[model samples]
Target chain A: DQQVKQNSPSLSVQEGRISILNCDYTNSMFDYFLWYKKYPAEGPTFLISISSIKDKNEDGRFTVFLNKSAKHLSLHIVPSQPGDSAVYFCAAIMTGGSEKLVFGKGTKLTVNP
Target chain B: GAGVSQSPRYKVAKRGQDVALRCDPISGHVSLFWYQQALGQGPEFLTYFQNEAQLDKSGLPSDRFFAERPEGSVSTLKIQRTQQEDSAVYLCASSLGQGGWGLRTEAFFGQGTRLTVV
Candidate 1:
């Protein structure tokens, strides 16, 4: 059973527009959630994270909204640029045992110029 | 190294062969983790080490998979009797904090080692 899921395999957005990527989870034990961006032939880099205590976190043009009761989260990028094109992965960690991160299948986002 | 480093960016092995994947974490990082990513799938946690002690190995797939962090700096993941299904990209990541669940330490990753079992 997948604890975290990114149902959309891919998404496309126009530059200067807003791009929204969604994720869902089944496990309620997850307390910390993170988003990662990965480019071709490179490792994933941390983008942003949110704790369960908060409902939203924002950094620059990027914002992450969490709905704990719905078991869902979404990443919003305003004024999306071509450089934002990449695979986005959503991961969650429980509050114990080294906090092993559980990842989703990932969503490929393409920002058209 | 300035960031996490993984050796043998690519590896090809035949069935029944044994392969070892190496990971060099950032200098002074206290937490190390190993994850396996299959095609079109996200990375799955395999194991974790806090300094020299392995705090978690629950994610390891099977008995054939083994990992060690002898000196608390470098880690190696070994697979005995490779199978075709074992093909995947093995990723290594590290954090600067000790073993704490509530701590929000960011983990940095390496380019990973792609393993192909023929």
Candidate 2:
């Protein structure tokens, strides 16, 4: 069974617009959520993360929001640029349980110039 | 190296051949992890090591899969009698701490080695 799910397989947005990617999880034990951006032929790079204790966390143009009650989370990028076009993976982990990360299928985001 | 390094960026092997993939984590990092990502799928955990000691390996897909980190600085993942279903990109990641602290410290990943079993 998949503990984490990214319902949308892809999303598109215009330059300078806001891009939102959503993810859901079935495991209540997951307390930490992370977003990683991956380019073709490269490994996923850490973007932003939000702890279950907080509803939101922001860094630069990237912001991550968590709704623990809904078992859902979202990553928002404002003024999205063409460089932001890539695959976005949502990952979850139990802070004190396992050291492994459970990832979603991923969403391919296209930002038009 | 400044980041995790995985050797043999790509590999192709016969269905029954054995193959070994290597990973070199960042200097002094105490934790290493291996993940397998199939086409159109997210990365799946394979195993984890903390300073030469494997703490978790429940994610290993089969008895054909094996991994070791004898020196704690480098790791190797070996597969015996490879099959077509084993084709995937194997990724290696490392963190600066031990145990679950590795995740908290944010593990850095390598470019990954793409393996194809024909």
Candidate 3:
């Protein structure tokens, strides 16, 4: 079973608009969430993360919102730029033990000029 | 400072051939991880090492996959008998910290080794 899930396979947004990517997890034990971005032929790079104690985290143009009640999280990028075109991955790690991160299938974000 | 570096950025192997991939993590990083990324998919956890100790091998698909971090530095991932299903990009990442905070620490990744099993 997929504990972490990214329902959207791809999203297209115009420049200067908001791009939203959503993810959900079934496991309640997961307390740490992360977002990573990957370009072609490259490893995924860390973008931002939020601990379970916080509901939202903002960094520059990127923001991640967590709703524990719904077991859902969403990343919002404002004024999406062309450089933001890449695959975004959602990950959750159960912090108490070996702390392996469970990842979603990923969502490809395309920003149009 | 140097990030994680992997050799033989790309590889091609026969169905039954054995292959080995190398990873040189950032200097002094205590935690190393191996992951596999299939086409149009996210990277999947494979194995993890803490310094020279193999703490987690549960994610490895089978016994054929072996990874080692001898001397607490450079590491290698070897596949005993390559299978077509093993065709994917293998990524290596490292973080600074012990097991307790390892998950919360940011992981710096290498460019990855792209393996194609024929």
Candidate that scores best on lDDT: 2
Docking tier of model 1: it is: medium
- Cα lDDT tens digits, model 2, A24-93, are 9999999998999999989888888888899999999999999999999999999899999999999998
lDDT of 3 by residue, B1-117 (tens): 479999889999999999999999889889999999888777888989999999999889999999999988899999988999999999999988764222546788899999999
lDDT of each: 0.92, 0.93, 0.90
lDDT of 3 by residue, A3-98 (tens): 999999999999999999999999999998999999987888999888899999999999999999999999999979999999999999888766
Instruction: Give lDDT tens digits, candidate 2, residues B4-67.
Output: 9998899999999999999999999998999999999999999999999999999999999999
TM-score of 2: 0.98
Task: Write down the TM-score of every candidate.
Answer: 0.97, 0.98, 0.97
Better of 2 and 3 by lDDT: 2
Better of 1 and 3 by lDDT: 1
DockQ of each: 0.68, 0.67, 0.67
Name the 10 consecutive residues with the lowest summed lDDT in model 3 chain A.
A93-102
* lDDT score, candidate 1, position B1: 78
Question: Which residue pairs of candidate 2 clash?
Answer: none
Please tell me which model should have the higher DockQ, number 1 or number 3.
1
Interface RMSD of each: 2.3, 2.0, 2.1
